[model samples]
Target chain A: MCVNMDLMATTLPLLDTAVAKCCAEPGSAPLDRDEADAVARLLKAVADPVRLQIISIVRCSEGGEVCACDLPSPLGLAQPTVSHHLKVLVDAGLLERERRGQWAWFSLVPERLELARRALGT
Target chain B: MCVNMDLMATTLPLLDTAVAKCCAEPGSAPLDRDEADAVARLLKAVADPVRLQIISIVRCSEGGEVCACDLPSPLGLAQPTVSHHLKVLVDAGLLERERRGQWAWFSLVPERLELARRALGT
Candidate 1:
């Protein structure tokens, strides 16, 4: 069962592990279950083609934001499909959403990506 | 329909886009379907809790390598389960494996993670 860990900000290791060094030597402690789950959730969010494209669209957008309506046409996907991808990204904390009028604008969260990059055991 | 683009290294975008700048402008071209697929494949490999823990364990090993037989105890998982995760990481180019005697040793692939990092639209 998936736990809604959103509210327990103090408990999640995202911030702590974000700057943690990669495992470079043997005998190091393994990633605990919660740490692995937290990192995996971030990775899963970017594990889809549609989501990756959606992230790229939002990240590339000038003014650091893109409207929900502008996403589908460029990717050749349906509106609902695009919206779905956006929600997943938001939930993963990889993107931020702001509602303006009738449209939702999305922006990339570089810190989240950086945390994932560091987690790669690099 | 996952094509084995492995043999056709010339065709994969892993190299070109690895250095490509993130989409930082609104009118920037979206990531092509192929690029998205390739990046997603890499992400999918690390999108699971078990896989992430496995990666961490292997990465932390000394001499930049870890024996497959030594994995299960630290992670408290079955041997076959740990092996399966190792295989997925190997297939995704995130981990490299070598055989010595009867054991398979796994090591981290920093370059692959670097590419995935750049692909995060960061």
Candidate 2:
């Protein structure tokens, strides 16, 4: 278990780096195609109404974390639909998921969201 | 002509109000459908690579504006494609366009971008 945990730690930074590289400030300079593509991918992840609401709900939840099971009713979405949106956010590095018993709980990946905010360069 | 200008002035705030109403801080609370939809539309406008690059280039340009004709080469896109992206940005209120002779110039609408930044609540 310790070896498995060590391996997991080593792999996570690589994902963070990928997110960071794509989120370079857009107002700082003209973005090349690759930078633009990466940044756009991040934006697209949050570009849907359902996804935007999901992020908002997760961010504002008490203790800064929310359970996947608790999301659907407030969102007025079905379970599968909410799950799909959560998956998209998790894939985007905007949210991290942890399994607690039989259910997954989510917390904001604050750094990733900050990178997205800065990428907008407002 | 003065009446036309006055009419334009009178009409613009309603549009601004609409944009403003929808861009409320997302982290403040869960977003209702309309607010989420409006925010999503703004995100969608900037959610493409070419459009994101256009925004960056325009923001970084001298005098805070760029002519429509100058965008294609840097973006490696054709004029018509660039124009379509510009229209999307303008329609979303993230950009304002001015016609100077035969060329159209574009500049950022700082407030709109700021609202988007705040909406992200990072």
Candidate 3:
């Protein structure tokens, strides 16, 4: 009855396993349900506007990193909102956050981005 | 008032412009607000799991692409749902769709992916 593999309420793990194997062995064969799902969840995390912008700004910053405290003003957004977005991006492995003094700084994780780029297989 | 450069609700276009120029010129230094915002939006598009899987499946396909009609069954999804996901990926310039005889075939756009890789500057 489900048209989208994503429609299945409990298919997350199955999809993730499928994608994990597929990404782990790119030249082997097509990705299974589990692997595909894992990769998707990661993507979904980065799919929101707020999260993406946070990533872009930090990536484009000098040294490809930014301090958590300096982020809110340029975006003209509330502190909590920006913090929430940063949390999402960092959790997804796309951005790496580190604590220094009383502030946290973020920078892009090139390996993760490279993994996505490689997924294109183009 | 804001902590993130992304705190501003109306800064979408500004970020977009900044990212466009930055991407258009990769060798350049840090991205401006508009450029970062734009890049973030594009990243936002591919951030969803369903969308990422669709791209992944198509990318892992035999010819680095896939036929729309042949996709749903493998992913255990429905037609309309899969179609919606494809539209998002295509709209983002990550995948290209072409009509041939009885179905649509989608292939990755390497150039776009390459641009993204360059954006990492790592």
List each candidate's DockQ score.
0.66, 0.40, 0.23
Tens digit of per-residue lDDT, candidate 2, span B15-66: 3443444343434556767667767777788888888888878876768889
- In candidate 2, which residue pairs clash? none
Q: Which 10 consecutive residues of model 3 chain A have the lowest summed lDDT? A: A1-10
lDDT of 1 by residue, A1-122 (tens): 03434532644455356326344456666677777777777788888988877777766666777889898888898998888888888877788889999998888788877776776654
lDDT of each: 0.73, 0.74, 0.63
- For candidate 2, what is the DockQ-based docking class? acceptable
* Best of the candidates, lDDT: 2
What's the ranking of the predictions by DockQ, best on top?
A: 1, 2, 3
Per-prediction TM-score, please?
0.85, 0.79, 0.66
Candidate 1 has which clashing residue pairs, if any? Answer: A25-B60, A26-B61, A26-B62, A60-B23, A60-B25, A61-B26, A62-B25, A62-B26
Model 3 C-alpha lDDT per residue in residues A1-122, reported as the tens digit of each score? 23432343465455445545445333445665556556566656654656655666665566767898887887878989998888777666678888999999888887776555554343
Off by over 4 Å in 2: A1-29, B1-28
Choose 1 or 3, whichever is better by TM-score.
1
